[model samples]
Target: MEVKSNLLIQMDILGLIQANILTPVVLFFLLGLVAARIKSDLKMPDAISEFLPIYLLAAIGLHGGLEMRNTGFDSMLIPMLTAIGLSLVFTLNHYQILRRLGKFNIFDSYALASTYGAVGAVTFSVGLSFLKNQDVASEGYLTAVLAVLEPVSFILAIFLTNLAVSKQIKSKKKSLSSDLGNNEKILGMVDQSKTNLSGVLRESITGKAIIVLLGSIIIGYAIGDKGFESISIVFDGLFTGAIAIFLLEMGIIAGQRLDDIKKVGVFLVIFSILIPTFNGIIGVFVATALGLSLGGAVMFGLLMASASFIAAPAVLRHAIPQAKPSLYITSALGVTFPYNIIILLPIMFSVSSIVHNVDGSINLFNYFGIDL
Candidate 1:
């Protein structure tokens, strides 16, 4: 029976891999990779490249808002809280590991921590597509979870950056008290760091992506079912196709940066892959413990596993100016993103399947005798 169980797990994993790899979305991503590999001069237009993300985020937000209206805030409260807690914990933990274990500088540590801690919008979309392909249903309100994860991770990272700067300034001031000029400079630096937190919060909250997603969600909720129906043909109908195209562009971009992986060194390359796998497993367990269904658990796992290439870079490049872009961006886009798409998604889904039971009738909560 033990052998049979192991074999069953293997079979399940194999089935998931086959199903995921054969999807049109994955195929388009591979095509983009191929185009980039051969230097085929295949390029997405500048306008379309910019428009796709907006369309996708708006569509997801609107759909989520509609679902949120149906499900109500009470049902979503636990999940949102779970998401917030996860973001905080993940960012701090990753920062510690990068600082102590990886021996990275403080800025780089915070940047990488925030990047990996935040959720990926496109990856979440791919997970939804994967679930749909498998005939699995997840709550649409999981979009709220996605929205909550990104900014919180970044905000925490910014706060940490300011804290670190403040500490260093104090250290410098204590050492240079005899020098009035140096003391004044240090005081100015201290003031700048203190003030930067507000700017960080504003930038993070008002980011183009956040605005679009939040706006769409509000709009979606306001319109409700009847309103969604009128516009469903645009938002709902074209979502998957838009994702495919966006991924194709993503593949090309990631493909172009394939060389940077070597530049980031073997430690970070391995770090990028291994950490996310660990995060995915943890995410699955946490989501299962929270009484989420199999599909919801898998989606949550994807959120935890995904690293932010888009939003993190936009913020971190400005927020933590000292950190190298290559380390975070290359590791995310070149390594972690693809790994999550091709490999981690199936692993997460399979783990969620086991946690939720193959028949989907029981979850970890029920097995553990916990009442939800």
Candidate 2:
């Protein structure tokens, strides 16, 4: 029976890859990539490129908010809080690895931390599609989990990076003060950093991304079915098309940095792949232990495994300008996103299934009042 189970898992995994890889959205993304590789004079309009990310994110938020209406907030409170806490912990875990193992400077370490910790919207879209294709049902409130997790990592990364940068500046003051003859100036600069950090914290909390996502969620929750039904078609009907446009733009952005692979080094290349897989397995365990269904378990794993190319990059660019943009963006969109959608998602689903089966046996044992 074990041998039979292993073989069936392998076959199902193969089917998942085949189905996800052949989808129109993935194909369009590939087309953009090939265009970039060939240097085909392919240029997305600057306006379109800038506009797509915001639109797609807002659309996702609105839809997620509507879903939250369909499913109330009461039952999902535990899973939502668990996801947020685990997400922040996940970010810190990677930040430490970047600082200690990779020997990255504090700014770069925190920036990479934000990138890895934040979830990918497009990746989640692909995961949702995967679940639908499999005809698996997940908790609707997983949508709220998606909206909240991105900003938690964003806020934490900014604060940590700013703290590190400020400490280093203070450490330099006594030594550099005499050489530069500017002790008073140094004190003034320190004051500026504090004010700046406060402003950044304020911006992050009320940023367009946060406002649009969280605001939509609240509105969706408050309005419930009838009110949302009035506008659901606008939000829901255009979601997939918007996601496709988003991915196409993402591929173009990623492909532009393909030349930066050497700059990213062997360490980041390996770190991006391994960390997500580890976090994803942890997510699967959390969801299952929380008693989510198989589909919800898969969504949790997928969210954990996805690296953010959008919000994380936006926040890090402003907060840690010293860190190289090409490295994080390329690593997330080019390497990590593709890896999750094609390979890791299927593997995570398989693991979730095994966990469910094992858990079932344990539940049965408890039912029978049998102890070893």
Which candidate leads the pack in TM-score?
A: 1
TM-score for candidate 2: 0.84
Per-candidate Cα RMSD to the true structure, in Å, reads 3.7, 4.5
lDDT of each: 0.84, 0.75
Worst 10-residue lDDT window, candidate 1:
1-10
lDDT of 2 by residue, 1-372 (tens): 445445535566678677667876777777777788888777778898777656656655665666666655576889988988988999999989999999988778887888888888778877776665555666767877887786778778877766776786778785776677677677676645432566666776787766776777677777766787787676656666766676677677667777887689999989989998999999987788787767789899888888988776667777677788887887887789878877898888877766666334334223222221
Error of 1 at 248 (Å): 0.7
Candidate 1, 211-254: lDDT as tens digits: 88889999999999998888888988888888899999999998
Choose the strongest candidate by lDDT: 1
